[model samples]
Target chain A: MKKGKWGLIIFGLVIFIVGVTFPVWYGAGTSAPAPVLDMDTPVIKSMPNKKCVEDTAFIRAHHMKLLDAWRDEAVRDGHREYTAKDGRRFEKSLTGTCLQCHSNKSAFCDRCHNYVGAKPSCFSCHIVPEEVKK
Target chain B: MKLLLPIIALFVVALLAACFAWAEAVSLLTILAYTSFLIFAAGFVYRMMKWAKSPVPFRIPTTCGQEKSLPWIKTHPLENPANAWGAIGRMAGEILLFRSLFRNADVKMIGGRPVYGSAKWLWFFGLMFHGSLLLVALRHLRFFTEPILPFVNGLSALDGFFEIGVPALYLSDAALLAGLTFLFFRRVVLPQVRYISLFTDYFALLLIAAIAMTGLLMRHVYPVDLSAVKTMVAGWLVFAPVVPANAGVMLYLHLGFVFVLLAWLPWSKLIHMGGIFLSPTRNLINNNRSVRHLNPWNPAVKVHTYEEYEDEFRDKMKAAGLPVEKE
Candidate 1:
């Protein structure tokens, strides 16, 4: 009962220090060059307009939310027409539009997801098409 | 009269959160959220380490049982633990069940007769308050996790089993409010309790109540964009934080109250959260008679040796016919 808690002190410090570096160390597993996320993935570069439904910066910051909102609107609320700022219209479905060009999820989505060690749940329910597999 | 300052303090904090929300101070909120977590965890760990610094130089566990000596006499393992394992069991019981508080009783003169009964309501409400608060925290993990665990989903589902509204009302929310109300009122209604209640005690109750109320209002009345909230949380997880452009005022208020709670935890009586685990009385085994306890703080002092005493006493001993070693 009177003994020093050196075990507890060491344990607490280990958990705290290791936990602090978990996100960075978890994703940075290999020294190999990470794949680039770009518009020139052979599909988007071939399109007439190399633009998404939103501005480039906005899309980068809010693509996940946009996708989530689209899911609720299309699947839950049953309203699907999503108008892009440039007067183009598209169905508010992830698999229908967003994944069409970014069909190579392993390349584009996983590149960022794996790099950040973020496990986005989109692939939990959505499947890769027969022709889309790398 | 004393409660005025804390009340104003609570109002000011609530106002700040609302302001942050309306202004869409996303980056500030992000910074505040992470800073709050770091302060809470670090402060708690620091306090725990501080407790470890003091040496409890005696086996002075609070015991209410016969000592473990005579073979024929029965020993209460829990009340007076003879060893470490028994001490662990006692600590676990106290921590998990609030065993001492459960035994609380208050006598009242009813019809010129002293009445004695279980303070079941006090125990029940206290249990409800802490239990519901824990469950509510667990339910919020949905906003933090990507493929949020099944247990979190299941906990929220169980909490909202009544399904009373658009967002599905949670039983924990209601229980938390009711329990807080009871505790707050008890402090005000009972003269003895009210007399002893400091401003901080009332402030703690009101603060948590406000948090629960504002949280419920956000979920049920003026809802924030939850998907946006989750996205921000996910970004925070990956060290790629982005403040949401449209996260509303209620979220800010709820978060602000949480910030205050985190900052106050290490300094508040609420630190019993960690203290319960470290409490010597509750955690130590009662084995003073069986084992010798040494005080590390007690240092050896210069002393006159028996031989020295005899050497000095030799002249007197020769006159008084006393035995002397030096003589």
Candidate 2:
């Protein structure tokens, strides 16, 4: 076998050995805790409550109107012709334009969501614009 | 040829995992977590560097449209992009829609006659597999963050739209497993694919399967304290890195397997995810005639001019009655 193949084999072996030995090093034991469902506790909920507003239809209509306004703004800002891979042209919308208002995510979204029961995963991978503190 | 070893490795790991139940032992869980983390961290970095250093000697972009020549011909600019912007657009379509795979065809011999069939199954399966996996990954975000996002809740609701179980059944967990199984079976059972299958390929599929299996086991069989697990994950995310004492062994094994997969990603065939962008065939335009592609890395070299060559071979040419530049 080539040296490279041998190296790979050795590496795989090392990984396998480590995986096997890990359980040995750390004792295998389980401790089950009582399940608690506390609704009032504000730990770290991150999702916005779509149910907070009474009228869904009104909210959707407002959202659409906001989107139309955003589309017009995008067009005026020279971001009108959004061409896709299938040679299709689309006009860009600004309604769900995350970067615009939520430039400071924790400030804009988190404070409200934390008050309710929503905790989103956006903070996990992305840096909250507010957290940068520049 | 190297396919046998990974299978053996997988079986060995699974057997070991079965032998050491995390619920029964905490030390084992810690060992597994730390070991897997180390392997994952070291392995991933090594693989990425190796890929980044690999040499590409030719421009081999796969094109499906007309070349950008003779203005009247009308090039399919997006499909076969001639510039960076067009390439980006094409890449986005490919990544998001699997456009090429969507246009895939299957050929078979039916009663001695060659038949071409629209093979949408591959595309459908690919979409389902990837989409489901994305949902599953996104769903996992609930376990890693503090207060769960409403989008995640909504996504979970949408995923378990049928609402078959008490906590709600996630279609992705089942679909991902089934899709992976199908893909794995295709590699092993199909004579054509089996012949070309490498150990690493099988290893990747098995590792993913193990992760999914462990995750499912934790949810249904063992019933882990997800709140604690989430807290632990959140700590890790926030750079605090708190190892939860209450977290189950299955979770460790699952996390270990996931870490191994991540570490293996940059080095293995999985790098194709990133390499697709670097792929000359996928990204480059077939415009050899329209534009000169001088290798950016090419060094300035002294050239042997025709005059110098003739001067060197003048005597030999004269002796042989051959025409020479000097003569």
lDDT of 2 by residue, B47-152 (tens): 5445445654455767778868887899887877877678778877887788888888888999999999887766777777777888998876555433455677
- Cα error, residue A49 of model 1, in Å, equals 21
Interface RMSD of each: 8.5, 14.6
Mark the regions of model 2 whose C-alpha exceeds 4 Å error after superposition.
A1-134, B1-8, B18-50, B111-113, B238-249, B297-327
Q: Who wins the TM-score comparison?
A: 1
Tens-digit lDDT track of model 1 for A1-104 = 46546685567556755654444354443222223775546668789878888876566545766777787888898999999888889999888888778777
Per-residue lDDT of model 1, residues B108-134, tens digit only? 899999998778678889988999999
My TM-score estimates for the predictions, one after another, are 0.71, 0.61
Which CAPRI tier for candidate 2?
Answer: incorrect
**What are the candidates' C-alpha RMSDs?**
7.4, 18.2
